[model samples]
Target chain A: MTASPDQIVVRDALKTYGTGAAEVTALAHVDLTVDRGQFVSIIGPSGCGKSTLLRLVAGLETADSGDVTVFGADPDQACAAKMIGFVPQVPALLPWLSVEGNVTLPSKVNRRADALRRTLPGHVHREPADPRALLTKIGLGDSLARLPHQLSGGMQQRVAIARAFAIQADVLLMDEPFSALDEFTREAIQVQLLELWEQMRTTVVFVTHSVSEAVVLSDKVVVMSARPGRIDAVIDIDLPRPRRQGLLESAAVHDYEDLIRGRLQTAWAAGPATR
Target chain B: MTDTTDTDQTGAAPTGATPTGAAVADTALATAATAAAASVRRRQPSRSLLRPTIWLPAVGALIVAGVLWEIVAINNTYLLPRLGMIGQAIVTQPSFYLENAGVTLSEALVGLVIGFVAAVLVAVLVTESGILRRAIMPLAVVLNVTPVVAIAPALVVAFGFGPAPKLIVTALITFFPILMNVITGLNSVSPPILQVFATLRASRFEVLTRLRLPSSLTFVFAALKVVFPLSIVGAVVAEFSAPGAAKGLGTVISVASSNSRLAVVYAAILCLAIMGSVLLFLVTLLEKRVLRWHESQRLLRG
Candidate 1:
């Protein structure tokens, strides 16, 4: 019953915004752990602290009371080691930098992390992906010299994806990365994301509001409830490998969707009635 | 619904089309127009200077203003010198005008460079330290509000009637705007992008170089546009306060007007105007090169 060496463990983490009178709890007594290389999605209503959870894991926010650890180290330590790559909901590319420049930014800034990675034991030896090649693979080769403002929302998001992948991080924290796209574009990107994830086997903690999206991509769907946010349920998705659009139309997929949807409804009802 | 579809198919491309069909057609039309416009834009080889809307109106306006000035001068020679008279004055002793203009331009250029570097350094410091920003910004505002004219005489007395006082004046006039604009531009990076940098464990220096400094170029250039003219004005004012034989354009104008050499004064003023325009044009050219990817630049192209 030994814990996995590469696991992320969050134990009774609590976060609140503002001083006493204006205080609003973001995450209350939230406890979760994600195994290495697993794709996990957290789905809930708007105030359910999914994003807060992700941020805490990324070391962007600290818990008020509890401990959050990544690979036996604190979140900040893990972040400093370049073990965490965060993709926010927005594309967040530097507007002044060309697409290629933005994608290579992490590699340029993370020299210390590279040295640490080289010394770490049991880490696989791999050459970092070329920024231009990655962009071309994601259909942005021609746009290498273009700035972020010159790109569409979808293309900008793709650049963000390329940037995250280029960081060569162990765990990628994505907070609703596909939420801004149209449905068709979102589906296309989800597939592309899946393919990318499958190729790299990077652990992912994705936050989203879509039930179908959660069921489609995650190895486990973690449902949360609002009003001092906490996890309500964790549903395991036992679908086959290399999941595709065709699998989305199958009855088995519908059953998983129904199960998650039913759990989500209860989680939603359990929250404060006002919301 | 079936009958409507049949009628829609059989009839002349229906005038009042179905929503879906109309939307599809609209999308196609918009895409085609965008592609055509893009192609047309690509075919042109940096023709922004040749565009009628850009330079034509400016040249035409200048000609019209000159003609009106000449007509007004013909009636009132005591106050306004005729264009011909100014031209004659400029032609008679070109060396005097050239030497004076050269002195002013050199002062402005040197002061501008010093002010620009100092402002950028101070902006970086202020942006890095909240305490310093709070402490310095209020004092900057106070200095900014003090009239340059009021300070020119004090500067002249302190630094004497040489180019030193004029250089100080020009630097002082240009520094504030650059500082303000640089701070604003550095702070304007999206929070999400900052988070991205943070997640990568980027050092403060790395963030400044890779993100903030590059992003601030447009704002710095925008500030330069204001500083360019003010630099000239500050240099001129400082020149006006100069004692003997300083020989800047401002000195030329002052001497000419006092001696009732109206045409010489007009000639100096014309030189000043041309210098300001040339400096502005050069700054604009630099801005276009640096901020080629900026949205404002793209909008200008269109």
Candidate 2:
């Protein structure tokens, strides 16, 4: 069978914060691509610019140079088209809005995005999931009227996840969505996320610090180094589907973990790359 | 609620694993219902001021203060009027004090409404444009620092013995705090949420209505609590300073004190105190109702 089309593409993308003596490169000449329906995780140590890369893809920040595209359009165009979904590290749910209100917020906004999409010749179109149904699938069905603070951290992130999915965007960019959660909660939410992703088949670019988390949730794990945040290696997980709790202890998963860990160590030791 | 929750769960249950899934969902729902019931019970007590936790000590302290004032006034009759004498004076001509209070209260209310609207409009403009913020904020600060009470005679001289000067003074006194607080509240949104709105491509209007304005309610209420009582003070001060002003609580105090009617003077001051407290209380009640979802209100309840 022919391969799926490229849904996201980033070429030589560079991003920096501050200026002069305080200048710090967040993403340096970052090049990456995510195919349609693929689950890719950008895994690295802290300060590795994975979140910056996600932000760039989400069109929340601009790259200093190079190209970033979603569905062959600029990130801003994709954002305006409502083709990009983002889940921040913190849930970032609007405090005043109830869970249902928060989940359904995207529906109330970006009507112009649809009109813009209609102007395009070839555009990705998918059915937006009902917010209530998505909430139920994520085990927060009864909390529709509850405020964001009324819910636990895990539950709030679940709402965030549901909200991101409710938009039915072409690509989902998550920045450490589960890193704040406890291990059990994270794993459980990971399974719930995978179940949702399996049904929607939306291209996902997730950022995380966990090795096994990156392996289990993503088809391809991108390992990045710090100081000058750039891709160190990209490892393909050939493991079978339904990668549940039991898969974490499996020998093949451990092998992939070891390989990623070893590369991460070398990346950690590399320090700032000399010109 | 439980029935609705059960129906939702049953409807969501898959086709094949009906028995076990239904049992699990039932158990989960039962636990959730218990927790919800417990939370509801915990939050059941109304926050009305009549509640013993608030009013019991309030009444007790008020009685003790009244007795202490009576004792002090017995020794120093020249300065402090006895509580009973003040009460007698008020009862002797209740309509006189009431009419003057009515005039003062009307001035304060009208000025307060004008001030709030003007402050909110200017706040929106200030937040929308940096140039406006720079131009308007300093002028507001200048107005705030230049004692509005000191300007009452000038307003009276210019405007000619009318209510316009008193209303203008009250509005000026009440404007700055609300403007400052509103500016703070509008800018109080966290960066990540702003980013989320940006990603959603929400229009400026949507961002203002759905995000900025809702978040600013707490700050607005806080400013209102201070400025509501200050509005009354402003109107009274204007009446005291404006030479031609003949009918207000402040004028009653000025005339009675000059005539050595200490009881009447104390009575007018007492009326002003009660009016100020009532305005503050009304503001608080409105705050509680509007900010039920806010963290500050939740913390107060517990």
Candidate 3:
């Protein structure tokens, strides 16, 4: 194992969509590095390219001009190796699959497609720790037999969370996962998220519009500007967990929230394309 | 279910329920009017418990019609052919009707399988590649637009008057809905759900196998429910065109028509209806079994 404290490094990243007259620059010279085990949440308005940034790191999209290295390796290459685990906004569990099958999905997707493929089944598509144990870790032990449709929205997302952990990836990326959920479910999942993070400390880069969510779940919140999305400010959250909504009741949390919203509001108002 | 309806009622209250309830009420009214009309003509299945009641009246009507036919045809044996005469023919020539029915059913089953498989392959290929989608979609539409009647003779000539022509017809007719619905289902992956897969470092194969295929299953099966019967119809019609030469009820019906075996034709027609119903029923069974996880199935199960 490489002894490295920094897992992600993005240098002068540029992302442009379309070409010529129709060309729109989504990201411009975005330079970011996330340290190992750091819980970073990128907060911004819609169209702020926070999702684009995460996608850039996840290898879901390519940067026109930049290098992104995760775990001291190329992000896409590491992802292909099953080095990064992603938990998206809506739980995209296979509907035909039961909860157990959904969680085991990543494991079934072969990591080594060439050379060792025939012999790669055991390590690549693992039936490691019983699904029960993995589900228990994410507060979803009882849902293994249920399908996604049978579960509530929050429950479904939790299963998504369980699947990500089940993959045993070293890094995790979540993008506005709780935005559509109700307040109670969001908070409950947030608490569960912290517990999961504590157990695995996988370098995480979460994107969210909710300032309070960023303040509650993140170690550092990267507030961003609109349109040509860029990091406006980075606020460190030192609140201790097992976290509760009471943390937000504190003046410090509100101050952070206030700071983020103030930055976002100013950024939002100054944009040609409303964020 | 009650809780959900209550929640919806309270949340949306006036507008949403009004429109939805109006639609439901309109459907209910139409069904009621249809049942009433059927009942006036005969007896209808009015009670939910009387599902048998619905068919009973229709059978009674058929029997009444048959008696009238027997009365009318008692004098001229050429037209209706006495009911007793037909019954005698059915009893004595059980093999004739049974054999033709079996042949037709088998042809339908083969065509259904071929069509289903072809549709699924087309759906998967088109979903995966945009160029393939652009290329293959128009071909599918052109096939759909080509009338079965117009193509039946060509198919018979090209494939010979064997099961090949009939199977081709069925496969052609049944391929559209399954392909269309499955494509829609596969592409229906919500952005949020896709984001979850991305975060997990889930491979393309993982996303496709786990998310795309499974999610599209309900849509696929829904298409099958419609297409299976169409396949049966397509196959039978093609066989009818090929008459006496092809192994199907359609051949029997055509031969019977020329021979003036009117009772035999009716028997063949009944068998055709049964075959269509059975194929549709089989698809329904598969849907219920496979998509027990789908929301529609969950609501039904609940």
Candidate 4:
């Protein structure tokens, strides 16, 4: 059963802070929808409620007014049903476990270790490959037995991403999982993530401030505005899949990049006057 | 780098404080006057195997002090005795002092164990509830403030001259620091660490086990170091206050003091010293075994 049109629907979703004097509108009267299997990126500057939006989709927080649904079910219900996987920016692996153990934890947690076993590729199955193969896709194979400290910054975040995928969830919600990495590592991970997305065809709602990253990764970039963060534009990137570092040099990616930068600057300019 | 040249020429790191410590001063003078010297390699952190060096010097210093006292009191056997005389008393009266030492050590150990268990449980409770902390913190203040000397008499009168009073007194004496340190340790999970756990939706127990407990081990062991001597002091005070008590090291010392058996008194004192050192040693060893991944313990590894 592949994805259809009305996959994740948000209707009149409101998240307001305190009332009257203490009032703050975090996500005000937002309404948008991403089709099933759509790779969407919600890109905006800091405090544009990008994180608040992702948290809503992940079912980590509730909407104050309206609805958020995943695969025709409520976000929270669908999440509990193991329909979503989240990779927070921080490396959230339990420090006590090895990398392989951390990657396999989500499976073990759900009484679904057999899923990881079945998902193992033939070349991986023959040689007793580590579950680290998933992590290795993100370039952390050398650290199977290593703890979090032993690995560098980019490597630990790779483990966190692998752990998310191992659970075999349909949706991947990432919150700028590579902002902390160096430029070289960040680009490398972005390319590798594209490869995983092409193969899995899973929907992703990536939250990021980097316009270039959003342009490179998403099929649709849903640009957000300031304060009571509402959608400004939903720019589509119809570029081909398995795109390379060379693709970043292409006119298509740059065209989308300029378009998002223009929209974000306008949002930023209007932001201060309202205050 | 040339940034290290001054330190390299001096062959010693400068003092961390405003003034130089003896270790640094000794290094500079000793180095400047000499050459072909081996570098001071930050003292390759002493392992459990190497830790005995710390005790050896202290014991040696004690022995030297005892010898000097014996030399001064060669004729006056009442106030002080010869080092040889104390050694003879310990060896010849093996059944006499050893039994008493054993009795005192056992009571101290039992008190420490009971006190430790009670302290940990209360610490966990206090950490969980502000109400419980408010209720118990005052009680802990009372326990800490009430000296063993004053309370030992009442404990002895209640539990009598047996090991019961001695164990109870010691337990009360050793409980406060252990409880306070443990409570602080249990609640010491940095907010960031807890947030990581919570965002992962890790269970509260998992958070406690992996994060909180690992952090608490160091503090708990520090409390153990403080409480070890307290255990012995408690046992001794309990016995000393109840002079009617027999079969304790304190009883041996009290009797020896009255009869002017100076060698026996010195022998009992030696036993107490040995007991304190051994208990502290065991706790340190346990800390190393349990927390090999700890930063302090990892530094100690090399």
Candidate 5:
């Protein structure tokens, strides 16, 4: 209840779909708190409500019960204040727009939202980053005028990452953003993403099913179980900073990855029958 | 390595003037070659236009069809005129066909403009409101299923004679395709993109204008390909129903056939075909320009 202006707090948030005989619970009693500028990952088996948690925090879906707050305000208010940026699993660049156009769209739209927010008393507004410079930093300078279909899968995902960074949001929620890329491209983008995050210092809540991915990018990984989805455990990643491809071969990184994998296996085994 | 050493020894021999002069000659030759290649590249597209494979088959087919038509007309003169006679009629009364064809083209174009705007407006409304979509979609389906030819007479009665009925008929024929296409395009946005817009806190109007509208352009153009021909057919049908004092291509066809001027009738039919082709070509050009960034257009260029 004492969540600060820079933190995201979720208190026993629940979400359900359908009704009566067909009713299904997606999330149950999910309580999590992501502090300011912390990179958190949610990892679980399929249909374990990992993405549902991100959606709740994004204000895209309302929790059936309990509360979710961002920066001491409702998720809706936080979203309206242009503090949340989301990247879906698919690289959802507009097909009609060039790479630069897609990257700049959020910034342009946020300007209008910012203007509306300023009409209200005591609203703080932050200027978004330059999209061209951001795209160049993300290594997409050569593809500014290329359409979405012209780019490879990995390139498109990088564009999506650059787009999320371009918005200059206080918090970013990504849903398995690199899931579609090959292993090599995924690692490259991970490094690029880490560099961007390090520079911006924005809070991130990334949802993924890959243990190595969660371990590599997140400060803490929240593991959840399905069949009435709920969080089972939280694992803190103690690996050193500036995590790079070299760290992937390190014994310490392997140990952390193995620990999370073991917990995920246990969580998967502890199903509805055990509950 | 050996080549560099050889060049170095040669330069060290105090005959640098000879090597330097040779290098200058080589640079000039390279520039001349590059310019020649550039000119060839510049001429490539126009050369492709004149290639035998591109135009020969089409021209051959047209000649064969013309010969067949002439032969058939010699045996059945009353039913089908000779190709030469139709050409003579077109050459003799060019102004008559031109004026009537212009009237039909104008009607179709006006109706298309009105129907396109109305379809876009209705599509926007349906996309924004679930209630309107539910109520209006079924009615649109019913209208689409009803034949325009069957409605032409009723339209003539409702709007009376003159161009009003023709315009309505053309609008009616075109409205449904545009509506269906616009709705499909507006709704075809990927859910992930919608989620991105939602996260950005884009206003409903912004979502419609920025995302939905641009996404719908390809579909709109696709629908236009069908609408172009359909609009002309509608105008001709409407003219048939009510061809007052204002003569259109449909009136020309009816009048010529009644007077047994089969050549003039064929000439009018040719004019209609040409009009349809021209409109389709214009729509395609517009589509290429507007959808240059789309994958379909990109694939087409390749």
Candidate 6:
């Protein structure tokens, strides 16, 4: 059994889109490592390839060069093992499926993943959480039978969150999941997500543009610069565990947010000169 | 049902029913009354259907059209048959028209079923591979552009003077719309949802059955709406162009018109029109029931 503490490793990963003059580099020699059970958030400007980085880790795309590994295996293998869970910006729930059916969807289709996971030495397999109980925990108990369209935007996002959590995946990748929601709904769901994360302690790599969100949820916040995306800084948030919305008022949290913002400004300034 | 509506009217009275002395009792009573009224309203399915306001214009127009038709027939009996004479012809030998109507209806239905199943299966296969799609789609388009009426006589020559030519011609006419619509539907799954399925390692069958098929339903229903009425047209056209031993409304209309039996011709045409309308209504009803979860369906309900 391999005993690496790091659950995810991205080394010198480079990805580009298009070709010829129109070709643009999405990620340029980006490197990141996420420790087991760590909550890491990747935050940057719109074109910083934060989503590209998340997609790489989700095995949804291949890097032009370098490597991405989860649980000592390649991203595709880990994904095949049902070890990667994704929550996209949109809820992306099946329109015909009820909230319960949407939550239970991963479990139903993961037969191939299950068999792959069994072959890995020292891989601990827990029975997936009951989708109903997870839905209730996420405050969707009453909407169990409702289709995705029937739920409000926030409620639909919560169901999406519940679905990702239900698989008990070793790695959860979220791409700006709360960006579409209103301010109040976003904050409420952020707290709910933290609570869920505390229980699971699965390695998470969340991509977002919100600085406060990154500071609140992540153990390590990865700030990337745009124009050929590269990691500009990695800031460790020393906030106490069981983080709540109440902590947003504290000075320490504000300091971390400011520090990240300052670093981001520097990264942004560092770009145009090269262009 | 009467008692419920009665209670609803009384319960919805403008605040005067509340007792002055007991405010708490008044609140509770008001709440119960509102709940009862709401439930009663829900139990009465589509009150708009029964409303005179909704039906008055439609009924009035039909009545006016009927009177105008009768007046026209009185002036020109050869060209425009009186409504009574057409009705009399149908009443005198109802079984003859009924039998022919049944044949046309059955042919349309059987052809529609065959067309629908074949289109769906082929669409599913086509969606699976670009190679098959490229190879087959042009052929389908070519077939669609060729008038099935023109092909009906050749079909009769090829398949003999039986029901086969009529069924084939009908199936050919209805196939393209459904195939095109279902193909579009199957490919319409959102990228994020497709990625979710990919991450789950969902098999091709799973993706097709659970995601693609359900996603395709709204499109399928849209196509069926057009195709249902068209299926009847296809059968009639086939019957007209390729008449053999079979007796359909198309054949009846043609035979009556040649003999200048304008009443029987119009009567046969009336049967065809009614059959088309009833088929279209059934498709709409099925769509409403099946696509209840769809956004278009929900908006329609409102």
* Top candidate when judged by DockQ against the true structure: 1
Instruction: Give the per-residue lDDT digits (tens) of candidate 6, residues B1-302.
Output: 45445544643442222211122212345345334544554554467568676678899999999999999999998999999999999999999999999999999989999999999998998999999999998999999999888898888788876788778877898899999999999999999998987877788999998899999999999999899888889888888876555699999988888899999999999998898899889889999888877878644443
For all predicted structures, in order, the TM-scores are: 0.90, 0.90, 0.80, 0.76, 0.89, 0.91
Q: Summarize candidate 4's per-residue lDDT along A211-252 as a digit string, tens digits.
A: 998888988998888777778778899888778877789998
> Looking at model 6 chain A, which ten-residue stretch has the lowest summed lDDT?
A1-10
On a 0 to 1 TM-score scale, where does candidate 4 land against the true structure?
0.76
Per-prediction DockQ scores?
A: 0.43, 0.30, 0.23, 0.07, 0.25, 0.28
Candidate 5 on B9-118: residue-level lDDT in tens? Answer: 43233222222222221333423432443344344446555867667888999999989988999999999999888899999989999999999999999998888998
- Candidate 2 at B17: error in angstroms? 33
Question: Tens-digit lDDT track for model 2 on A129-245?
Answer: 889998988888877887765566667788888998998888888999887776766777888899999988888999999998998998999999887889999999999887777
Compose the digit string of candidate 3's lDDT tens values, residues A1-275. Answer: 34232557778889988889777668878877788778999988777778888888888888999888776657656666676778777777777778898887677665563223223222233334465687877766655775665455666777877887776666788878887676767777888888887876667889998888898888898887766777777778887766776666899888888888887887777776632
Q: Between 4 and 6, whose DockQ is larger?
A: 6
DockQ of 2: 0.30
Name the candidate that leads on TM-score: 6
Distance from true location, Cα of B75 in model 6, Å: 1.9
**TM-score for predicted model 6 compared with the true structure:** 0.91
**Candidate 3 chain A worst ten-residue window by lDDT:** A114-123
- Record all residue pairs in model 4 with backbone atoms less than 3 Å apart, i.e. clashing: none
TM-scores for chain B, listed for all candidates: 0.84, 0.84, 0.74, 0.79, 0.84, 0.85
Stretches of model 5 off by over 4 angstroms after superposition: A1-3, A110-112, A115-127, A273-275, B1-51
On TM-score, who's better, 2 or 5? 2
Off by over 4 Å in 1: A1-4, A118-126, B1-39, B42-60
Q: What is the interface RMSD of each candidate, in Å?
A: 7.3, 8.1, 9.8, 13.0, 15.4, 12.1
